[model samples]
Target: MRLEQITYFLSVAEHGNITAAAKSLYISQPALSKQITLLEQEVGLPLFERQARGVVLTQAGVQFQKDLQNILKELEHAKKNAVLAGRAQKPLLNIGCFDGSYADDFLPSVYDYLKEAASGQKLVIHKCNFLEGHEYLEKGKIDLWLTLAPSWQDRPGFLKKKIAWRKGALIYSEKLQVGKKENPTWEDFKDETCVLVKKSQNPGMFQHTLDTMELIRLDEGTIEVVENIGTQISYVKLGRGYCFLSENIIHGSKGLRCISLPGERGIEVVAVWSEKNAAVTNLMENYPI
Candidate 1:
């Protein structure tokens, strides 16, 4: 009728004596005998034949013991598998990247580091624009964000760490020879069209570009905003404009010449997440910049 009754019945059946079975179960012989009597009454069959020396199993009792042993074995198997399944369910680490191009340079190293450092955990990645990444982080869709340090980095409830600084550079067409100098300042491209991605895609980078342009005293209409990176690169390759990009992004491209920006003012690439994420905190602490 109950699991404890079944267990008690099995123990009595195994020992062939109520006194020995009660000793094994750490209970009184009368208590063990009472449980077996209750089990026999529930099953509506006599489970034992009384003898002076001990007890012998009735025909029904032998069959019942065989069936109960199989049932107990299955219960044990299920419990073990449940424990194994719990262990196999690894913690997920969802990471956000600003763009596919950023992932191309950044994710491989990060994936490798996490694979070794946080073994048995799952890793998931999403590539989206900076604003979308920020939204994902705020809404709990992503656990970490990799992007340029934004204006809100120092705000409360967020944690931001600078992992690396990528130097800024100008990507211009080879045909447009603005200067023979290997490294040029923003002043060198005063007359050139400054093609840029949409400000909404990356407001922080856009503000930085605006600040640099202001420092050079460039005219207001000199900047051109495009919808995407491919369009910006196309404009530069056609000698129609030049664009500011991190050196890491434009490296090894064939048609464009990358001239470094002056003063070594590099863009800070950061890892950001909510301060409430203990997993993110552990990751930052383990993998320090």
Candidate 2:
């Protein structure tokens, strides 16, 4: 019945295994197991059916989990309102950013809008990988997620709103022979090495590149992975390899030429938030895409 017990139960349910959930919750496995036991005793029903690999929720447990989620969300909302009313402090909006420049193009407008509509609200940004950002959103650690649409899969309760679209193109050094083509198809770069950002940083882009190469039957290209955007840009600039970049991001680069990929569709930038986050939902509805 305690809040900590409910949290432990939810963590175990999420991870499916006591050890993994304990590790995630930063507590001892025995302690987590004890909490679950206490919770089950109080509920007068066995919540999870234990198994060799992990555990599965009983039918009652499934219902309880859903109810707990709603209860926690409401409690969080109440807490925020209470803090705002009691202290007159700025409400915090924690945003998770998958890409370094995720907020560069659209956030200024969002800031302007918030200044007028939500005067006492404060915005905070957390830069992390796509998977980490998604985790934070799920755990109620962040209020909003701003990143490429493909970075995270659509979950049942999360609301995804597309904010912008940018054309895709190959960015290469002007000195490279591959850059000589006015428009290059995948075949043109089949033999060239491709510089790629780390998969963890942007798995969607990495998979898209693989899929594109597979579709064109161009499997001969070398793939080089770098840690970040700066490294990818440096590789392309020095002619070490070429990389794919959005058209909006390619503007004003001095030594690089961006060639449109054949039949390339643009990528979408989206703002995603939980269905329970009323503040973010409101902001998304009013903000221009």
Off by over 4 Å in 1: 1-89, 151-153, 175-188, 219-221
Which residue runs does candidate 2 get wrong by more than 4 Å?
1-88, 180-187, 215-217
TM-score of each: 0.62, 0.63
Error of 2 at 186 (Å): 4.6
Q: Poorest 10 consecutive residues of model 2 by lDDT? A: 98-107
Across 97-132, the per-residue lDDT of candidate 1 in tens digits comes to 766464466667767777777776777666667676
**Whose lDDT is greatest here?**
2
What is the Cα-based TM-score of model 1?
Answer: 0.62
Model 1 C-alpha lDDT versus the unseen true structure: 0.76
Consecutive 10-residue window with the lowest summed lDDT within model 1? 76-85
